[model samples]
Target: MSIEVGSKLQGKVTGITNFGAFVELQGGSTGLVHISEVADNYVKDINEHLTVGEEVTVKVINVGKDGKIGLSIKKAKDNPNPKSGRHKSNPKNNRNGGGDRTESFEAKMNRFLKDSEDRLASLKKQTESKRGGRGAKKG
Candidate 1:
């Protein structure tokens, strides 16, 4: 069949790489399901979700002009509203998955900026101190 964008099709996993899995779609067309598209959550390893010779349902998210088809296994699944962005919860607890996030996105961003600035300032101070008093003792 013709592989078009937004079409769901059954494909066989022909190869697995660190970045993504190559799926052979109907009509002998091969597509790549990126590692990030393998699951709803973070997928550091594509092999953990898919393997060679495995049949999976993939959605044709994109089709490049150069014959490259981009597929998404997670998108093929029936999810009315898929969550976007990194799914990290409870920043203080340092755990993943859905958890109580008392802080809003803007609050979290501001907190991160403050922390980052503090760290950068400390680093600058340390470096300046090291270089300020030392300009080659005798050279």
Candidate 2:
């Protein structure tokens, strides 16, 4: 079967590597399912999700001119509960979420300056404590 972009097909996992998994598609063609495309969440290891000789449904994301096919297992599965992967600014939790709210330019600048000063002071205190205060020597 000819592999086309945006087509979903079942394939056998032929090989597994640190970067991705090689899938044997229909018509004796092999494709790569990159680690990032393995799941919606972060995939630290490909082995955790795929195994050799296992059959999985993958979506044809790209077909290169050099006959290299890019597939995504996550895209193939229909997500019943879709959650926003990106950070959405919630107006209700402005203080807790640290989200941008309607504020004047001067007010924002003041807040930023205060935050920066606080962080710097905390870092200095940590360093001082680590070094056993100023002009302290290691024994």
Candidate 3:
């Protein structure tokens, strides 16, 4: 079976790396599922998500000119439950239901600046407190 782009097939996990998992599809072809395609969330470790000899349903995302096959376990699963994975309106929540729409660039910068300022002020106060205590040691 010739693997083509957008083809869905069952494959066996042949290797696992920090970045992705190697799958052996039918017809003795192999493909790589990037870390981002391993799951709907942040895949810190591909081994934790997939193991050798495990069966997975993957979609052929791309077939490079050099014959490198790109597969995605996430893309194959994304459309089945589009609304189910939608994240709720909670900024602090890290749950991976699906895609996340974060603040705009300007808004993010503003938030970052605010947090940074708070941290810097706290650090300066701590340093001053330590410096003030150092003088008491000698006196």
Candidate 4:
């Protein structure tokens, strides 16, 4: 069977790499599901989600002129509110499968200010230590 763009097919995960996973689709065609297309959250590691020999349903995102195929497992239909324009929430963002409001702007601003001050102080100390607790001595 010829694989076309936007087609959904079941495939076996033949290989898993840091960048993406290789899936063997129907008709012996192999496609890559990029790390970013594996999920909506930060996929620092792809192994955490899939492994070799796993069967997955993937949508064909692209069919290159050179016969390369691109697959995606994180399409809209796979998650809730696919048309909401919001990314599928990561587990850390939800509690018990329920929506949870994140920190407000004021709270975020306060935290940013505190963190910035700490970083600035640390830099100043580093500079002072290198200069014997004063400005850099002139040559």
Candidate 5:
């Protein structure tokens, strides 16, 4: 059977790399399932999710003119509860658009400056104490 875009196919993973997994499709065709396509969430290591000779269902995402096939295992699975993979933004949280505000910019800046000065003073005191102790060390 010919591999077509958007078609789901059963295949066996032939090889795996840091980037993606190579799956052998029907008629001895091979395709790449990128690490990003392996799961809905972040995938740090492709090896943890796939291995050589593992059977997987992959959706054909693209067919390049160079005969390269891009596959996605996550897309092949039917998601009953569909939701965006990333966090959705709330209109109420928009600062530039003038939504809600408890403090003005100048007030916030003053508060930040005060906190920074406090932290810097504490750090300077700790270092000075350590330095004084070192200078007073006997030979």
Candidate 6:
């Protein structure tokens, strides 16, 4: 079978590592399903999701010129679980309005100026104190 990007195929998990799982595709070719592509949720451990010799459906996500194949098990599923750790609530409806509000150019410039002035003043104060309050030290 010709393996092309976006093609879905069944493969046997030949090896498992911390980074990813290696699978032998239908045509005796091997592909790697990255740990992040193992599941829709965060996969801290690949072993928890795949085992050696197990069969799994994987979508060909990439095929490098070097003959390395990149697969995604999550994308092969009919209905992948929604991404975890993402709140379902809309941020725009939140009190901060989802941080969509933009600062006007003038406002941003003013804030920057104020911050720069404050930093400069603090630096000047530190330098003055270090030099014995600005006046030359008495011998």
lDDT of 3 by residue, 1-139 (tens): 7788898899999998878899999889999999888887677878888889999999999999999999999888747545333453564553334424565889767867998999999998899797884555654
Distance from true location, Cα of 54 in model 3, Å = 0.4
Candidate 6 lDDT score relative to the true structure: 0.88
Error of 3 at 63 (Å): 0.3
Stretches > 4 Å off in candidate 2: 87-100, 121-139
Model 5 stretches astray by more than 4 angstroms: 88-139
Pairs clashing within candidate 3: none
Q: Which tens-of-lDDT digit does each residue in 2-73 have in candidate 4?
A: 887888899999999889999998899899999988876668899999999999999999999999999998
- How high is each candidate's TM-score? 0.63, 0.75, 0.61, 0.59, 0.64, 0.65
So what's the TM-score on candidate 5? Answer: 0.64
lDDT against the true structure, per candidate, is 0.85, 0.89, 0.83, 0.84, 0.88, 0.88
Ten-residue stretch with the least lDDT total in model 4:
76-85
lDDT of 2 at 2: 83
Model 5 agreement with the true structure over 62-111: per-residue lDDT tens digits: 99999999999999988822565666567775744764377798987887
lDDT of 2 by residue, 1-139 (tens): 7889999999999999999999999899999999998887788988888999999999999999999999999899977236643354466757636655567889888988999999999999999998789888778
How do all the candidates rank in terms of TM-score, highest first? 2, 6, 5, 1, 3, 4
* Model 2 root mean square deviation, Cα atoms: 4.2
lDDT of 5: 0.88
Best-first order by lDDT: 2, 5, 6, 1, 4, 3
Off by over 4 Å in 1: 80-139
What is the C-alpha lDDT profile of model 1 across 45-136, one tens digit per residue? 88778889999999999999999999999899987344455554446775334553786899778877998999999998889788774563
Worst 10 residues of 2 by lDDT: 80-89
Which scores greater on TM-score, model 1 or model 5? 5
Each prediction's total of clashing residue pairs, residues at least 3 apart in sequence or on different chains, is 0, 0, 0, 0, 0, 0
lDDT of 1 at 134: 54
Candidate 4: clashing pairs of residues: none
